[model samples]
Target chain A: MEQSMKPDGMEPRTSSLLDWFTSTIGRILISLFVPFVTFIVLWQGFLFLRDSEAPKLVIALVAIVWGVGGVAILYVVSNWLIEQLPSQWVRRLQPFVFVGPAVAILAWYLAIPTIRTFWISLFNADSSQFVGIQNYLDIFTKRFMIEAFRNNLLWMVIGTSFSVSLGLLIAVLADRSKFESIGKSLIFLPMAISFVGAGIIWNFIYEVRQAGDPQIGLLNAIWVGLGGQPQAWTALLQPWNNLFLILIMVWLQTGYGMVLFSAAIKGIPGELLEAARVDGANEIQIFFKIMIPYIMGTIITVSTTMVIFTLKIFDVVLVMTGGQFGTEVIATQFYRQYFSNRNFGLGSAIAVVLLIAVIPVMVYNLRQFSKQETF
Target chain B: MDKKIGSAKRQSRIRDFIVNGALLLICLIWTIPTLGLLVSSFRSRDDIATSGWWTIFPHREWVMTEKIVPPPADQQDRDQPMTFAGVTGTFEELREGVEQDGKRVVWIGNKRLGTVEVQEYKWITNANFTLENYENVLSGKRYQIVQGDGSVKEEQGDDLSGAFLNSLTVTIPATVIPILIAAFAAYGFAWMKFPGRKILFTLVVALLVVPLQIALVPILRDYVKLDLNGTFLAIWLAHTGFGLPLATYLLYNYISSLPRDILESAFIDGASHFTIFHSLILPLSVPALASFAIFQFLWVWNDYLVALIFVGSKPNVQVLTMRLADMVGSRGADWHLLTAGAFVSMILPLTVFFSLQRYFVRGMMAGSVKG
Candidate 1:
């Protein structure tokens, strides 16, 4: 076989496709070209199979093949292609090969839509005409949107403060206790629950039955047991019902705050607290003067995170009140405008408002992160 | 000096007790809401509607009364037997015999004739609990079936099992696709020499906080145009897109911080970038990948908005969160079903939470603290 190949190399008449592919540029082109074509073909086939009116078993088979087999093929082909390139070319192109798909998807999905939302915010309700800032003005002047802003403000102030303060208090108290893990775990348990689930749980707690019916809601039951009327807590509480909704968020977030603050507090040198004590400072004084100052950065981080979360709050409000009884926030308001009312322009405006509200917090968070990285 | 130290010690001890008590109370307050729902899910509908979940422990008693009207004077004692409420039984026999009967009887206790010629019977009964709600919810039938034998049996409500499967179907691909895509991208950002790397990475980190609400309208419109609306593929793509920012950001952070020597050695051994990623980076990055996987899994599982929009509320495709929320909306008064449904939806996340709690917490910390 070697002697026959040598003779073919000398004559060039019997040069084969395999020998051509083994050439450097040929190898590079084949490695790059074959994988991409194969990927496209496989993807198209998968999409076709997915949309076909096939039997359940057949569809399932296609799904398995696409999920497992398709990924494996793509990986193998891409690796083979990368291997064929020169070291310098490979070094330069490898990152793009790896990261390009993610970047393309993100650009198509998030970045492009964000720009479109900004553009759509300038139009009318149906987005067929450019209304130009009318929707934005309505967001400020409309009663429900104003109420949503008010509710959001309440959540920001009350939710952030309560979560941070309670978290700090728990961290300090449970820091060295025997039951610290148990207590923290119980408090942290709500973090594991989705906001929707948390809303349902709290709804059960705030449930109200008519007079003479047994109070299924624990809150109302207790209220009635204390000789008070069984009020529909979410509806009848008015502005304060906003606090009730915020309470659910605080419940879920305080654990997160506690965990981060606890780590920070533990990082605080014991000598500082002891020094404060020696200087005749009491526990409260020490906490305010020493511990709080020390963990201020963490407090800001947690608070800003909660603020961003509060601004975009949706699931809990939607689940609990459906934005009825004046409990609307920016997120739920956007949802109603977009999905329920089908007001694309107004929804886009509301979404832009939410984006504007979040940017500062995110910027601040990023700055803090960069600052910490430097340290 | 000794006296001063002794008083300080006493004060500190008191303070410790107070602190412990406060934490204990707060913990109870935090956990009771969930505890109520859990207890209610297992309770009979009547029990749940009639009493608080906390009342399950105590023996509760209530007086139940049934009215039995006697025959008028014209029909009385003329060889005409008196019947109570259309049942052909003497009042004495009815009152005494109904207690021994298995069927629900209106008259089951002592009866007395009133001035209006109506007889009333009353009895005391204790509160009872049952697993009927779970049976109904899990089976997906909401109505009670009265058998030929005159006993009531509960049929299931709308099949939560089907919705559970739908949720798994949506969640698995949504979770898996993003992680795989993000892992490759993260590898590029972290180790590979790429142009505009810093700018792209910063863009991803910045996009991390972009409210998903902003993406909904335009994406939905596009989906409509592309005829991708309400398809599983639409949701899978949307979730992957929404999830990519965080996934890429997190995996990049973890992957970039990986020890450089191992990767360098792999590169030196004539291993290609993909080979090095497959053999070294992936296995070495499992901890990070596991953490991100858990995060994405929980996020997608608990997600309602994306699913609601992309998938719509079509029963065949509705995820658990959507189904649970729908139940709450349509059957608001059915606490038994609502409580059971809430728990059913929560079951998977809670199980994942408890089992991989360490990774979940680590993920949360990595996400927030680092960001």
Candidate 2:
């Protein structure tokens, strides 16, 4: 028992129930119990405030206090309780105290819901009956689902490639230039805008009017300037319109890739480039033989991230086309199935399919994380 | 050797020119769409409809617009005097009046120019910019309705003020709460030791890519059952959950890498884990905390998906992105309002982004590279 105890020699030699209560094990259980009860009470208070008929501003104020202040107090109180325990018990129980709320929240919110969604995927439309594999079958059979799959493929391939390559290109060019910061800042600005805002901003560029009418849209104005007829870029074209929508995402995400790649490029040892140049490698050869090989890990990281983003691309399509003209992607299809069509089974199945699609990249990412020994 | 040095210098100069020119063009391409939206938002609706936003600079142009209308049934004769558009004159005299006045005019044409056709020409200069769009959006459009007694009554119109408040209410707590929670968790994952730590943390990492759609249905159903739907608390909790993985991951990278000797010395000096964390770790982790704070702030502020499903469509509780989207759907052709609304939604994020950009970039780089 002493061997298991901390070497700090702070343990009290006692065995009675009340004395045990002050012992390490007793204090550990008490610490956990106190925080749990306090959390419950705080949760009840939050619920009371939420359902209360109080004014919104008052509720908002109370909530800020409760949210920010309550979290701080909870941490302080829990950590203080853990401190009251003997050193060994504190060591064993303290990690839980620190990581428990986060792990519990993750389990409750993300982990549990993910499992529940998978279960719902096997059930019928309202989740009233178990209809296994039928919804999954429909994902492959439905025309809209097929289109969504096709578009998602296009988004994953085209969007990810363009964003990554363009990001790499710009990062390489602006690596040490005088205007690097300003240029990257300008390019990076769109990443700050929400996808919905990006859709509207791009709409002005893609806006079309009658050929003879002065084109208010920048794209059509330029098109008309070049003697081409002003065409509805997003609407009048089939298959190609998907590319138009994809461009908005590329615009928003390229900066993310550029910033990441720029960091990775900056990490490449200057001596490597200098040696390559001394060995008669030109800029192009240096980029390919040296820089690209150097940042391959970052490239994969960025590509996998973009792949996941493009697979679940929703806001842009929903805002721009509302999934019209065969522009439906998987997330939009799931939204349509559940929200509009009221087909919970189909929607959950679609969501699960998206989950499955991301699993490969996710597993790849975990391997990378483990490879980096982040833990 | 002199000639060779000169040629090499010329080659490098040309390379520099190409590089600068390419980036300049790329920046222009990136900025022009947003610039168009910004410029278009300031112009009057008529001006926006008639010409491109690019026409606002250089020399203002005089544009002549012609509208043809059928002559009134009572005035079909070639020489009949006509009253139209507050002008009264015969066909021949109206032409003379138009030439003399050189203002907008309504001219009834003679038989050769089609007797039944009346031509109205207006020469308007495109040289106007106004803050009316922003005023209309921010202050909410107010309309004066003239009653039968000719008294004007002002009525309220839809603006973004309420939605703006709701977004703030959702964002502030959501951004803040996650940071505290994740910071504590990160400190544990970094410094503290317990069983199942590795597996538990791997679970969090694996969750980083779980599409939020998987959680939406079950959470929505639970919220409905709990009667927590459409409340700020509901969204706060939802965003907290969704945002935790990245937060933990990023903060873990920072907190774990802190020089171990400091923490070890603190422990040897009889500081408890809690005290050390509060005093030493918290202060040291501000950079990481700040990085994650900006990340969560921008995300919560700009989010539309989680807000739409969780916050629901109640007008008072709607967010800026939701309101902006609704404007796009309902007022699809209303470019002025849409542009202004989009700008409004973008302003806060853009400001936050530009102000704390270094931390933001540091956060992004750290997040991708995993330290």
Best candidate (score: lDDT): 2
The segments of candidate 1 whose C-alpha lies over 4 angstroms from its true place after superposition are A1-18, A21-75, A85-88, A365-375, B1-9, B59-129, B140-156, B369-371
| lDDT tens digits, residue span B143-231, model 1 | 78565578998654867776777677677777778888899999887776556976787778778888888888889889999987866
**Which pairs of residues collide in candidate 1?**
B140-B156, B140-B157, B140-B158, B141-B156, B141-B157, B142-B156, B142-B157
Q: For every candidate structure, what is the RMSD over all alpha carbons to the true structure, in angstroms?
A: 7.9, 5.6
Question: Distance (Å) between predicted and true CA of B337, model 2?
Answer: 1.0
Evaluated against the true structure, the overall lDDT of model 2 is 0.82
Candidates in order have lDDT scores of: 0.77, 0.82
Model 1, global lDDT? 0.77
* Model 2: colliding residue pairs: none
Positional deviation of residue A103's Cα in model 1 after best superposition, in angstroms: 0.9
List model 2 lDDT by residue over B68-166, tens digit each: 564554546646775545556676776554432333444434444533223334333455899877777766568554545778776454477666777
